[model samples]
Target: MAVRQRVVAGDEVTHVVLDREWKVIAPIEDYLEYLRQEQYSPHTVRSYAGGLASWWTLLEQRGQDWRHVGVDDLARFARRLRDRGSDPTVLALRPSKPAATSTVGSAVTAVLGFYRYHAIVGGVPAARQFYVHVTGGTMQSRSQYASFLGHIGGGQDRRVIGRRRGPSTPAPLLSPQQIAVIKDDAARFEDGNWLGDLRFRLLWSLLEETGVRIAEALLMRHRDWQPGTGTTAFIEVEPREDLRRRLRVKNQHFRRIYVGDELDDLYGEYLFLLAEHGFQFDDDDPIFINFYRGQIGRPLRAETVYDWIEGFKRRHPLLPAEWTPHWFRHFHATALLLAGIPPHVVQRRLGHQDINTLMRTYAHVTDDAEMRAAADWKMLIQRWGAAA
Candidate 1:
């Protein structure tokens, strides 16, 4: 259960495990290797590994062996997860409240996945026995049976995982007023500190205007910026890997976002400043660099951006709790939807492969639109009747 940090080759740091007693309960190393082989992101690998650790710790407390675990054991673990606040390891750090449903579900799913993997590879038949074979003419008929891992059935149904959890609370977006205030504050930078100011302003404007995720924006390279046919410029978001930096896109989907002449001009200034700072202009040089004292010209990292936001919050005590870069994305999406742009177009603009995802996330906007349409239709009928 001990989390240890190790420096791998090329001076890169990776979160690795220390030899702990919990390894007896689970093949932690092997599972992590398997995930690595499957190209799972480092974040995902850490999460799954942590889930397995928590499961093993809980089972150890209950004096139960994973090989002999049953459905009842998993149910009890789920109950414990729902009742406990925070991660099991960090429970003593703060007062415990019930964990969120999504968190509980993920823990359960992780445990189930572990067992399923071990059941097939470790030759433990009891692991497969933990699932209850769902049957009958109900909607589950297509499923061979329900196991903790997922549904097991014939054809495509076989080896499917558990049902996905329902949507949680909607993510909050920044009001236009709030955004304007933030922009005004950022604009206060003068002669001595213009670099940081311009960089942040352009970053915020790009997020507000184009709605690309922060990661997508940060990973952009000089060559990714293209000159459009007219006065506009475009930023291409491509799934890329930087092994030294341990950076990559989430889903590897390619999409283009067009920027107006103003943003393009702002970027041109930023590029000029970057060159003045002695940064490289190579094709692969990150458009956004870490301007902090020692790391100039190096690519920016997530932690730095987070720290910047946190510092801004400290400066503006009245800033909303939900005011983050992601909130800007939500604001952009809602603005587009309410502006009468087709949902499909907005989906493509946002680089969402699934329209259902777009609709579900912004259902509130669409619901309001539907209500307005309904009112207009009612008014039309009433006017026609009066004329008759």
Candidate 2:
């Protein structure tokens, strides 16, 4: 059996094909369809399919069936993934190598879901064999029985499932001086790369000033920016269902964040440059346009921006390897918090649903601010003592 990857609307969907017949297994196909109907993100579906395919291949190698899998089998499956790490070649030969805790956890979750679907849609003996228990509850003398096993939270057993590692180490936050270096480099046109320069500068500016995610910045349209005719300029971030390439905002929260004059000026210059290049400034036009190939004027893809940032970092070795588009978002929040902006105000600007999330995440930055205040207090106290 081979897993074939197909791209639909810029997202990859995986299909499992069996020998000679080149047909996907009915159950796996049904599971994929089920995911689609449930509206799981295409990326998520692809991940689940890949994990299932790995599990299926493992079962075939061991001369065992999916139905025969028990707690021990799950432990072995997790161990196999750990051995595989992230090396695709090694993963193909043998799922051996210690992968990150998160990676292994996702694969196990996929297997769990696959078993769950089969258990729900019965008649398969193998699926029946996987469950060890079932129970019923009575309401008004009418009883409803359900499987107490199979991937349910209160199921047969969950001990074999791998424990995910603790929260990831926070990304390295770029200081103000470091951000200025990137902005300066991005603002300068190199070898007639006008479009690339303008796009990066605009993106960097927005990330620095507004703290919007890269997808949100790339998905913005001319109309999304409201120069509020009165008080302040702001950008609207709301989910759009009509893009050629679907882009989802992280939190799916509708928000309007104010942009300062510096960003306003940068955007103004970018718009002028776009008009100079014969691109129409329609209200629906993508705020960021492709600069290369025939895709000019189309919404820029995340990968493209990533590649540009990577190349920029290569040129300037001072940029940290761990740095990414989201780093600038951290930079934005950290800067605001250090400058004494209210946590709730920063939460609104960052589009975080809860103020607590913002404060919790940036507490270290706030700690530094407190340290500074303490240092100032010490200096003032010493001065007063000397005067006395």
lDDT values of the candidates?
A: 0.71, 0.71
Which residue runs does candidate 2 get wrong by more than 4 Å?
1-4, 9-22, 85-97, 121-162, 166-168, 188-196, 241-246, 337-388
> Pairing residues by index, what is the TM-score of model 2?
0.74
The residue pairs in collision within model 2 are 82-97, 82-98, 83-96, 83-97, 84-96, 84-97
Q: Which stretches of candidate 1 lie over 4 Å from their true place?
A: 1-19, 22-26, 85-95, 126-168, 188-196, 229-232, 242-246, 377-388
RMSD of 2: 7.1
Q: What's the lDDT for candidate 1?
A: 0.71
- lDDT per residue (tens digit) for residues 1-41 in model 1: 43433336674434444434523333756666677777777
- Supply the TM-score for candidate 1: 0.81
Residue 65 alpha-carbon offset, candidate 2, angstroms: 2.3
Q: For candidate 2, write residues 54-161 as lDDT tens digits.
A: 777677666786676776676777777777723233436544446788778888888777776776785343333333342232121111223534336332332224
Query: How high is the lDDT of residue 357 in model 1?
Result: 94
- Candidate 1 clashing pairs, residues 3+ apart or interchain: 134-145, 144-153
TM-score of each: 0.81, 0.74
